[model samples]
Target: MPVVFVARKGLTKLDEKFEADFWAKSLDNVVEVIGNPDCPQAADGLEVGRAYQFQEEQSFSVAKKGDDFAKCMEQLADMVGYHWRMAGADGPGPFRDLFRHPGQFGTIGPVTSAKLAAEFATWDECARAIGKRSFYAWFASMRRMFEYAKTDGGVWLQYE
Candidate 1:
């Protein structure tokens, strides 16, 4: 089964109050993306029906961007894992644990090898169950980050 998850975007600083308003308005469609007025990638992704998260920083550094996205991935994984854990913690009856329960059908058990294998099986059953769009959006985001870097006198891998 494929499941859809939402990640909320957050913005910090801006040039002007109206800049935030314009940025927000521009990114109404995308789910979780935030950025400064100058870096409107988040907003752009959102306006185009993609998901992104906004971040406000002084410069466009590859390491910084990678670290931020790494943190975002961790957060996303934790959120999804915790959601499943909480939803399926209790049981309908004695047989609930033995069989797949309703409402929390795809949630995984403890983090052992068996549990990990089960989770991987669940994820491989359908790309969307774990999050395929997220990978696409993340790749686009990284590409955009590199594009911004290349345009700003920074090092970047050429993508042609």
Candidate 2:
């Protein structure tokens, strides 16, 4: 499926929600972490939450379909691999494997956003990396999305 990426300021509450949603996606009680079982990033008493914030926010834009996906990722496929359906084709990229994670809400924390922005920091640099200029607009938007999120300052990112 195609993905829509959005950025928002970090919120501890939002982190809670993501963790809740992450656990909810798993039909079982067990949840995996990167390494530490007791991931300190998660809040202590967080209730189940939804992507209510992502649906409510109207300030940003959603990039999807051929305009944002196929054509845009055409050149990007070489550096990141063929991702005709999603942002990251495989397990990792300069952007750390886009939306491949379950319950990452089509997006993630500012750290991941930083990883994305780092790849698309500049148009010339991005075009150089992906080898094209026509589809850099989406990358620009993706970069701006992270910049806005950085401006907001958050640990959680809302995705619709």
Candidate 3:
């Protein structure tokens, strides 16, 4: 399955935020991509609506804006063979629920994003092992989302 990770400014009132006007303005930018945000490409088959986490979020294809990295792929495969098992020693990290347990959308607050981003900044093949070229792109995009959220806010994620 192909999933996307979006960085929206507002999360409290999405009903009003994603009005028809918004779609009209962003329709061109709203790419209907079908691929995993973490991986290079997902299964090449029918683009079913249920294949996505949110029908409304089918436009979130920003996570798919990068070339694949070999070191990142190797580390991810060794550390977490499956995305669902992509948690941390402490507890559930990012992308854990997206693969392991379906229907589990998680959030990373700005404070935590800051901490994680800072820590991930130093991640190599030896450390936490997810901050390579493409892997770091995920963190970079997420950090950009946190920028919109600021210190008290963050981004909501969904993958299934």
lDDT of 2 by residue, 1-160 (tens): 4445433442333333345456555432221122212232221122233322321121334345435554555555545554534554344555433434322333344454455567667444746565455456666666676666543232232344
- TM-score ranking, high to low: 2, 3, 1
TM-score of each: 0.19, 0.48, 0.36
Models, CA RMSD each: 17.0, 9.0, 10.6
Candidate 3 — which residues are off by over 4 angstroms?
9-103, 124-136, 146-150, 158-160
For model 3 the local lDDT of residue 77 reads: 41
lDDT of 3 by residue, 1-160 (tens): 3345554332232322333455565433232223343321121221211111222221233344223322333344455443324444335444332233221234443444455445344433333244455565644544355455434333344443
> What C-alpha lDDT values do all the predictions have?
0.30, 0.42, 0.36
Backbone clashes in model 2, listed as residue pairs: 10-153, 10-154, 10-155
* Model 2 spans > 4 angstroms off: 1-4, 10-59, 62-68, 80-93, 99-106, 122-133, 151-160
2 against 3, candidate with superior TM-score? 2
